[model samples]
Target: MIRVAILISGSGSNMLRLVEDMTGDHPARPVLVASNEPAAGGLAKAAALGIATLAVDHRDFPRDRPGFEAALLRPLLDTRPDIICLAGFMRILTPGFVDRFAGRMLNIHPSLLPKYPGLDTHARAIAAGDTEAGATVHLVTSELDSGPILGQARVPVLKDDTPQSLAARVLTQEHRLYPAVLRRFSAGDKTPVMLGSEGLVRGS
Candidate 1:
């Protein structure tokens, strides 16, 4: 089984799904859940599930991104993770940190990608009159949210959809897409997964 480590910033809805799905012969098992915020709700959730948790409070290193990452690296490496899944991990990792794990790191973004790469993605999509909003699971790279895509799950915007509503739908897709991608990815298959209504049933 692959030793998977997940990082989170806030409520770990996606992180929760990733952990739950890695059961019953799944190729991966979540061994650690790390957070930048000590009070992040996800830490509690992870602890409840009996997974080891780490809190490297970014605030402790006011002007030192590298320092914070170094602190973050210690616990992450201790787990000897074969895969690092960034599920809503808010911090932008330094390139040196990204290089440490390279091909083994992955992230889930709340947009179709190459379309919306940053925060407020749902709001931006609505403002742009986008008929569709979705999620993308991609390899982590130095550039923000510009990594090679591994999977995408699209949801259509209603006529009067607000960012809040659009985000809800897209998040549901993310919960599904991230885990599906991770399962296949753990097996060393980077084939793009396409999420359908019934679930991730095909590769692109």
Candidate 2:
């Protein structure tokens, strides 16, 4: 089975979903759940599930991105992960760091991508009168959120939807989409996965 290391910054809701999915016949097993915040709630959650957890606090390095990444790499390299999943990992990695993992790393963004690349995706979509909003799981590249998409799950934007409500619905799709994409990706399949808001079923 392929080994997966998940990086997180907060609660790690996506990490939980990914870990839970990696069982029985799944191609990948979660080896580590590491975070940039020492007090991240996900650390406790992961440990509770009998998964190895780590913390490499970015605050310790101050303005030193390389130093932070270097410190982070020590434990990560020890895990020898075959695949790395950035599950709500908030830090923006440097090119040198991203290039090291390149094709082996994956991330789930809060937007459909090529539209809202950075933060505030839900608000942006709603403000623009968009009828749909969703999440995208993609290969990690040096550029921010611009990598090739491996999967996407879309939800409708209701007329009365606020960013928070819209975000809540999209988050559910993310929970389903990320794991499905990772399953295919870990097995060396790069074909895109399209999902709808109703369930994990494929979308047109």
Candidate 3:
């Protein structure tokens, strides 16, 4: 079985979905859930789900990214995960830290990607009069949200949509897209999975 470690920085709705899906015939199992904030709510949730949890609080390093990552690496090295999932993990890892895991790390972004690569994606898409907004699961590279795409799930941008409204709908797609990508990815398949507003379309 593939040993997976999830990193989160907030409520971890995506993390929960990922964890819940790794069961029965799933090829991967969660080994740890670590966070940058000690008080992150996801830690409690992961613990409730019987997953080991850790907090390598970023504040302790005080403007030191490498130091923070070094501290974060201790538990991760001890756990020796085969895959790392960044589920809402807010920290921007340094190139050295990113290189440590390299292709084994994955992240789910809240936009179709190759489009809005960073924050405020829903708002940006709405402002630009986009007809569709969605999510992408991709390999985590040194660049911010610029990794090779693993899967994409698109949702319609409604006429009456606000950022919050569009985000809510897109989040539903994220919950589906990330797990689907992880399942295929852990099984050694890199073919991109695509989902439309309806459901699974085709691997493109």
Candidate 4:
């Protein structure tokens, strides 16, 4: 079984889903949930489920990127996680920290990715008049949301959809895509791929 660690900054709805999925007959289980904020709701949710939780306040550390990352790495390394899953984790990780985990780290983005890589994906998609929008599960890399994609689930963008409505649709896809991507990664399969101007192509 793959021992997983989840990092969160907010409500952790995705973390809750992952825990529920794994506690069943799944091949991976979240052994730890760490949050940069002590007040993160995910910590409380993890406690309710009896999962180990840790809080490492990033703000307490110096502004030096490497120094801050070193403090963040302690609990994660101690957990000895097979994979680190970022679920609503708001901080930007440095390259050195990302390299330590490399392909073993994963993140669920609200956008289809390579399209709306950063924030406000729903609003951007609507403003750009995109016909399709969705979620992406990808490996974490030095570049923001530029890593190889593991899986994606696309949702149609209706003409009258607002940002909130569009986000709701993409969020539903995230719930499904993230667990499926974890299963694939745990099985030692190559992460899925998507080509520019083309759609998804299965990786060998």
Per lDDT, the best of the predicted structures is 2
lDDT by residue for model 2 (1-204), tens: 799999999999999999999999999999999999999999999999999999999999999999999999999989999999999999999999899998999999999997899899999999999998999999999989999999999999999999999999999999999999999999899999999766756842
Once fitted onto the true fold, the runs of candidate 2 whose alpha carbons sit more than 4 angstroms away are none
Tell me the tens digit of each residue's lDDT in model 4 across 6-28: 99999998888888888566778
- Using TM-score as the yardstick, the better of models 3 and 4 is 3
- Backbone clashes per model, in order? 0, 0, 0, 0
Instruction: For each candidate in the order shown, give its overall lDDT on alpha carbons.
Output: 0.92, 0.94, 0.93, 0.85
User: Compared with the true structure, what per-residue lDDT tens digits does model 3 show for residues 68-162?
Assistant: 99999988989999999999999999999889899899999999898998899999999999999899999999899999999999999999999
Candidates arranged by lDDT, highest first: 2, 3, 1, 4
> Would you give me the overall lDDT of model 1?
0.92
Q: Using lDDT as the measure, name the better of candidate 3 and candidate 4.
A: 3
Error of 3 at 126 (Å): 0.4
lDDT of 2 at 48: 98
Q: Which stretches of candidate 1 lie over 4 Å from their true place?
A: 197-204
lDDT of 1 by residue, 1-204 (tens): 799999999999999999999999889999999999999999999999999999999999999999999999987899999999999999999999998899999999988899989899999999999888899999999999999999999889888899999888888888888888998999889999998644546655
